[model samples]
Target chain A: MIKIETCLTPEILHLHQLEGKIAVVTDVLRATSCMVAGLNAGVKSVIPVKKVEEALTYAAKGYVTAGERGGVKVEEFTIGNSPYEHMEEAYHGKSICMTTTNGTVAIDAARKSADQVVIGALLNVSSIGRYIKEQQKDVIIICAGWKGNPSLEDTLFAGALVDQLKEEVEITDDATYMALSQYQSAKNNLSEVIQNHASHAKRLSGLKAQNDLAFCATEDYCDVLPILNGDEITIK
Target chain B: MIKIETCLTPEILHLHQLEGKIAVVTDVLRATSCMVAGLNAGVKSVIPVKKVEEALTYAAKGYVTAGERGGVKVEEFTIGNSPYEHMEEAYHGKSICMTTTNGTVAIDAARKSADQVVIGALLNVSSIGRYIKEQQKDVIIICAGWKGNPSLEDTLFAGALVDQLKEEVEITDDATYMALSQYQSAKNNLSEVIQNHASHAKRLSGLKAQNDLAFCATEDYCDVLPILNGDEITIK
Candidate 1:
């Protein structure tokens, strides 16, 4: 009985028994998308740190630091959370320290229980889906929602992944069905569907993130699977 | 701002600062629907107890005790958790002691912080919508999901209510948007939509609850808004 469950937000991660399961952490608005883009763009590795100061420590060294606090560039950091920024050739063969409000927090939490934690986003949906199918393990897709609330982008992304894997595993919970249904409904018109109503989309657009939003919504744009090893994310 | 939010499951109730807000508890499958039906049938009051022993205490006092623990009638209880069973004139002007797996537990939790807590369900969607609009206060819709995980039925009901009330309030979080989108997509064929994926619906149907499922899914079937004053559920 292969069980597939979803943590709609990081706040409920504690309630799930994730030990020995493959945890796919998705912060689709940009965290996982950015990290997956970094690996796909040929970055050496991405170190996920929970604190801004921790990212600063690696920046003080010759390693580049890239992160956002409230969807904007952190002070003194060389890069912000745009996938477009990470796709540049200059990032190739260089490791970067990264942090974000929701993504890294979820990655750190999933790290404690999951035997394997990987970054997931629309950018690498197929890659992550393929990887999970190959592993043949029970999977838990954790959506790194805004703070403690769910984000439509993440849930939609989870539904996309579920759509890919549903025939292979039993979706044991209704939350997963909810996501799959939402995704099925929104899959046809990703941008217009999500942008019209998503709270995070509204917040990001208010901060002028139209370019990033469009970039993140394009499904399977990258073939990178940013697998988590200890505290660092590297392409598998 | 008259903010509107939703707890997709009872486990996330602590994440929302529900203080000074009107909490609307929804367990669409049976509990809230049954309570709303009891109120509509002219029951004097329905006390929500969190435990079987607590309900038994009320039963000792000659009060009608009705509830379900694992989707079946409790032993020695006169009636089960079906709305149809409670629509009898025998229950009129009677205060029944009610307990269920998820609904009352949620109502008990909401009572601790919410300025006012009321039961909301498909049976009383219009009535609850009217009540919330009249209160003109911030609202939190609590979906009493199956156990601690999110349930499709409760979330769909929340989405239906969000669709009703979104224009009048500021939806402060993404969970609310998720629900609203779901409702928008599923509203046309709610019974078909929800029955397709809801885990609780499948479980109940397996236990010969087809009638109860159909009864609970009907929109505006009952007109009573069962308001929770402390622990007891009574109409306003």
Candidate 2:
């Protein structure tokens, strides 16, 4: 089997090469990580969109529009980028239309190659790997970098998936080794290590971001793999 | 001061944002890492180009055109992507134009904004960090993700840079953190972890790539940073 990899930036998408593979979409800094956190808190599903307007449009259809910019929850939206914010009381059984600077775009991009696109994050990293192995298909892990550039956080998640899945399949592409080695350096002091990436510092513009970072860092906290189908992302 | 936070792909230069920042370009799987290794092995400053034709034309000017496709060194070229291959006797003090799948594109993009764009790799991880800190300007660490997507291996290097420089500055991007965490996970199994990125597996297609992986996994071996100035990248 082939392992397809891509980084999400505004203009380019590795979607072309990811066809017929199990598309594992990761926006580790917030989206996928948040998805894992929100699901663990029992939120039903998250509908990821590329733009705030899309999230709003989806919310108009009885979904909660969750939007964040530069890391904080948009004051106008029901939820912020932080998974901790996602744990609030009103989240249960609700459909969230989530949009962010990086993750949302990544989720939307991964939608292109997704026969079965699973959200892979620090919260449930191994779950996605295990799922891919169980399905036994070609695996494509797309990192939704901030605003489409390669985010260190997203690639690290991809690297983690690579570490877990390479035993089962043949991986192709340069990104695989770049990430695997990078993961080797900072897997311990995650917060300190990622401080160099663009999104973490931008989100940290507010103080609560530490909680967001901490929340997203928890591993295997939930088993829900949010999969995108049509306009909605639901746990499969 | 605001830590310069940005991500780099094979395309989309982000020139406006990264302009005037100390740009650190990393293509760990082979390009940047191999560049460092080649330089360390006594090869001269490496040249980066987008197309194979450009490399050949440069070689006509008394330079060496090194090329790589699907990880293996092309027989026609004077050198392959492997740093080891670049350690040939003829390579000494000779300029080489490297055109790889993702790395050359990334180096080209960073050229637009770079006040001083440096080639970053596991080999020169700490020295580059020190140089950036000494400069006291915004530092932009650009990862040449695989064909514009975050390859875990590349971004993990970004994380290592972030980790090295965290106390010296700030990390605004959430993407950085995600990679940092993955780096944390892979730190213990450096050689094995690096062997798992898409680029590594792809490069290992025929050779004993495991050896290359082991070589790339050795961290902080060199304290030299290759600075990119216009079309020329200098090892400082």
Candidate 3:
């Protein structure tokens, strides 16, 4: 059976053995969700950078610089970390160089450790499951938590992904079991559960990004599978 | 409102703010459970050491040397990490120098970071809740997971403690929220849930420690509040 595990936060990613495994990195509140939406909207590719300065450097090469520091968009970026911003016609056929507090760092970390890294979010949950099932490889779901802390929304996404693929794979550890259990409990009303229980969702709501939260919580809105090839995430 | 949080595993303990906060450290399958049972059975004080050599040094000072590593009792120690072993009449009024795989490491970590550190388990869940409520300080429930990875039993205990104190304190962060939800889902049948879901419980069962797992799953078996005062844990 294919083995599956979960790293609840990027802070604990080091504890997970990602070598030779497919790493599905998730930032459901916005970052990975934005990638899924952008890719589905016909964006050429997304280059996830760890710093806003690195994203700005891509702007010199005509790439769209998009990022967020806290919940707000960085003043230097052309777009923020919101999924809706990436879903517009202006981003179609364009390459985005994106940076955010948690998502990019997690992606960068997973790329170095795993044999393959793919972006996962509620927006492409079923697609991710289908892609992983076809790969038939050991998988680790890495949650891009808020600032080295575990985020409820990311975990919820991880759980949702586990719920999708548990029957076809062997859940390896307690982290995966916890995520699956949490997802099982909250699957019926993910949007309401996340809005009420997730700290990052509350932070986003405070910044008037309630629409982003609702959009990110949506399941299978996009079938695009964002996989890291060299440094850029493109459709697999 | 008093703030309450959970450090799901000791690997992520540094991410939590423990200073001036009460740290309730738990290793439900069974280190902290052993401490609770020992203390309740009239053991004078339990000195938790991180290394086998450190525990052996106290044996020279007439303390009962007790511990386990990888679910087996250390050959150098007089007793293993079973609650039943700690509850024996031979241990009454005697001091124990104990070391275990995860629990002592977590206890040592929390003792240095938090203003006060106390041992917790399902065996003393209600008592731990009452004690923390009386303290009225910001609290962080530290789960002594298996090695550096999170364990289901420890998370379940953390959730149970959160369930007991949720009405009296502000549940802070996503970890606490996750713990509370897990506990809520499993509260009706903790023993069955743990027997089926916890990796540690399964490991213990493999080691012929099924009785220990059942004993540790029991709630309110003891009201003893084992608080770490300097180097030793004694009744608070």
Candidate 4:
């Protein structure tokens, strides 16, 4: 049986054995969701940088810079960390150099540790699940929680992915079981549950990004599976 | 309104701002439950040491040495981590120097970061709730997860404590909400849920410690509030 586990936050990612595992790194409050939506909407590739300065360096090389620090667009970047921003038709066929507080850090970390790293979000959960089953490898869902702590939206995405692959995978760890259970509890009213309970959702709402919250909660909306190829994330 | 948060594992304890907060550290499958049960059964101050060698050092001073590593009793220690062993009248009035894989490490970490650190478990969850309510301080439920990973039983205990104080405190963080929701799901048949889902329970059961699991699941059986005072845990 293939073992399925979850690292609830990037802070605890070190505790998980990532070698020989397919790492599904998710940041549902935007990062991974935006990547999935962007790739599906025709963005060529996404280069996730850990810092705004790195993204700015990519911008000089003709890559569109997208960044957000605390749910707000970085003043130096052309766009922010939002699915809608990335989904714009004007950005079609272009490469994106993105940086965020949590998501990019998680992606960078997972890339170094796991044999295979894929971006996951509610928007592309089913696609990620299908990819994992085909690979038939041990799975680790890494939640890019808010600034080194656990976040509800990312965890819910982890749970949703677990729910998608529960029958095909062995859920032996507590974090995976907890994530599956939490997803079961919120699956019926995911959007409402997230908007009401997630601290990141409230932060986004305060920044007038409620639509982004609602959009990111939509499951299986994008078929594009963003997988890390060297340093850049591209459609698998 | 006081905010309540959860540090799901000791690995992420540094992310939590524990200053002036009441830190309730729990390891329900054993450790903290054993401490609560031992104290309630009339054992004098329980000293939680991080290493088995430290526990053995205390043994020379007439303190009962109890230790467990990976759910088995240490060869050098007198007893393993079990609430049943701790409840024995033979140990009454004797101080215990205890060490375990996960629980003691968590307790030691919490005591240093938080203004006050208290042992928490299903056995004495109600007492912890009452104490927190009276203190009226912001609370951080530190789950002594199985070796730097989150554990189902400890998270459930955190949830039970959250349920107890939900009306009095503001539940702000996702981990706290997740714990409270998880506890609500299992509260109806907590023992069964734990026995089936908790990894630590299975680990203990392998060592013929199933009775310890059932005993630790018994809520409100002990009113003893184990608080850290200068490296020693005593009744408050």
Candidate 5:
């Protein structure tokens, strides 16, 4: 049976038994969207590093560093976390060493034991859902929440993906049901739902990151399925 | 400021910084309902024990032991998990020892460090909301899910409670907002929303615990505020 469950935040990822499951990690506000956009725009690969220093190490080794902390660009990084930056022609055919406040940490955690770890966001949720359905593996969605707490965008993304695959799979737990219900309720007015209701959206508004929010909220905007290879992600 | 947030399950309890907050824990499927029902029925107090052995010890001390695991009554306990059982005159004016798979563990976890921990259920949500507003404390709703996962019934109850208090309280996080939105959307047909959607409801149906689910799903059926005093719950 195709059983689907969701880890609402990476904080609770350790509690989930992901031994034989496919883990789709989402940090939809920016990080995962950036990675998806990068890979779709023909970047060689996206290397997710947990620490800013590690991103810097990759920069020294000729990869471009794209880092953000607390919604601001890292001091020494070549690019900030804007998805538009990755969509630029100069970024094409280059490797990116990326680090974000939440997504990289979740990726590192999921890397330890999940049979397969794939990056997901609104940009590529449809593609990722189809991929999971094709694999026929039990699914676990790990939401890369803001600093270990749930953010609405990631959970809604999980719900949206569940909506895509629910006809072909069984929801394994109540959280998955809640996510699917949430998506069902909010899918029609998603932009309004996230912009006015999500804490991260409100937070990003204060930081004048409206462009990033607009881009991240767009559904099926990219078709790349960025799967983890060792510590880096490449489009499969 | 009266701030409201939710820990969707005890598995995510540590992520919530609950040092000075009023922790309102809910296991809406039955445990909190039983505690609230017992207190409202004039029981002296309800002691929530974490282990079956602990409950058995309380039984040896002339206390009535009420325990459940996997949606059924403990083999050694007198009563199953029905709130109706706790409302009996036999339980009146006496201390009842209680343990359940999920609720007791969450209570024990919150009891260790929270400034104040209270039990909540649909039976007394209005009373609990008014009580929290009166206390003027920042509130955290802990959902005692099956094992360490999020359950729909508890989250919906949390959402219902947030719907009650959002006018006076500032939601401190996105999860709170999400819960409130969920409640707003589901409150119109709460019975349908919970009975049709919650995994626990389906599980209980399989176990023939339909009566418990029906009882637990009712709203504002009692007016007890089951506050934890030391380790036991006493109505306030």
Candidate 6:
């Protein structure tokens, strides 16, 4: 059995070892959630850019532009980083070029470790779980914590994944158990579960992200799986 | 109010900033806890040397030499880094020359933050707490996490201190609150609380040091405050 662990702090993530593993990158606030939403709305692929200029170049190429900066949607874009924004019909059958505050960085990190990378959120748990089971290799559930720091939501999703795949994987660290313990506690409702965490509270105070917490918290929302395929992401 | 924060990761720890603050160097698995137990048991002061030759040079001055290699105490030393061994009445009033795995590295890092530096553990929580409070400055609760990694015990102590002084300070990240929340969940009974952590279990597996965990967990057991007074550390 492969070791499934939660890295609360992003610096602790062993970025080099993600190769040949199916990496489930989670940024619960908006990145992975929005990626999941975009994929669900029939977006063919999502390119994550760390900088807005990079996103703009993709936008100028006629790719659908989407992202969030300072918690607000970037202007003149087809969509923002909010998963709620991905629900519109305009997002369907499009290739989305996105940049986000933290999620893309996490995806960037995962792209190295994983032979195939998938975006996992409460919005796409069941599909991600099934995808991992099918891969049959070590699965590193990478939680993209906020701003290179361990945020509650990412670790909570790590725990949620652990709760789903416990008997199959060997767990590592108090971080994993602590996260799973939290996931179990908050499984009924993530809103009450993450009330005290600073990042969640900050996101709650921002624009278009209130229900994002509850939205990201609800498990198995869609059965679709997002797989990163050679510079393009595909949903199956 | 001082920004008293527990930086859990080692690399994330601003090593160069150790120049100014009063640093409480701690490595609970044995280093700091052993230091505290030795001092409290009446050992005058332990002169910490980074190298064995330096410790041997101090050992030439009629000091009880103590240290560890590969988790085992060295045979050349009269004492080892076990808090229980240092707790004997025979230890009281005797000055020791010692070294260890990680605490000294932290002390070295802490020597950069500011002027005053001190040692902290469950044994002397209140003493260290009140000392930091009395200092009336930005208190950096540096947890000598294992090898610049996120250690469970060290972060737990950081959380404990945060819980003790949260109302008196401003905590910055979700890590601070998350640790405090975990400590709160486990405060009334630390053993049960600690049992959930992996490091505690691993440390308890073989070494006679298992009892030291309980001893260190007992709040306010030691009134002796170990502080770095210069190139050398002493009790304040």
Over the stretch A1-236, how does candidate 3's per-residue lDDT look in tens digits? 89999898888888889999999999997899999999999999999999988888898888898889987899988999888889889989999999999999999999997999999999999999999999999999999998887888888888999898988988878888999999999999999999888988778764448777788889889788999999899998
Pairs of residues clashing in candidate 1? none
TM-score of every candidate: 0.94, 0.69, 0.98, 0.97, 0.95, 0.88
DockQ score of the complex predicted as candidate 2: 0.34
Tell me, per candidate, how large a share of the native contacts it keeps: 0.80, 0.61, 0.78, 0.96, 0.72, 0.43
Full-model lDDT for every candidate:
0.88, 0.71, 0.90, 0.88, 0.88, 0.73
| Cα-based lDDT at residue B1, candidate 6 | 79
Q: Looking at model 3 chain A, report the run of 10 residues with the lowest lDDT sum.
A: A201-210
Q: Candidate 4 — which pairs collide?
A: none
Q: What is the iRMSD of the candidate numbered 3? A: 1.0
Residue-level lDDT of model 6, residues B45-164, one tens digit each, is: 877766677778877777788887655677778888778887778768877777776776676666765577788887787788788788877766666665545666676777788887
True lDDT of residue A9, candidate 5: 83
Q: Lowest-lDDT window of 10 residues in candidate 3 chain B?
A: B199-208
Q: Give each model's clash number.
A: 0, 49, 0, 0, 0, 22
Q: What is the lDDT of residue A232 in candidate 5?
A: 73
User: Each predicted complex: what DockQ?
Assistant: 0.72, 0.34, 0.82, 0.87, 0.71, 0.46
Off by over 4 Å in 5: A206-208, B206-208
Across A158-235, the per-residue lDDT of candidate 4 in tens digits comes to 898888888889987999889888989889999999989998887775454888888899998978888999878899
Q: Write the per-residue lDDT of candidate 6 for residues A109-190, one digit (tens) a residue.
A: 7787567788888888878777777777777777777666678778778888888888887766667776776677567767
lDDT of 1 at B121: 89
Q: How close is candidate 5 to the true structure, as a TM-score?
A: 0.95
Residues B1-236 of candidate 4 have per-residue lDDT tens digits of 87899988989888778999999999887899889999999989889999988888898887789969988889888778878888889999898899999999998898887999999999999999999888989999999898889999998998999999888889878999999999998899999988898877776654458777788889999687999999799999
lDDT tens digits, residues A120-174, model 1? 9998899988998888999999999988878899999999999999889899888
Worst 10 residues of 2 chain A by lDDT: A6-15
Residue-wise C-alpha lDDT for candidate 5, range A42-109, written one tens digit per residue: 88899998999999889899889997999889999999988889878998998899999999999998
Candidate with the larger DockQ of 1 and 5: 1
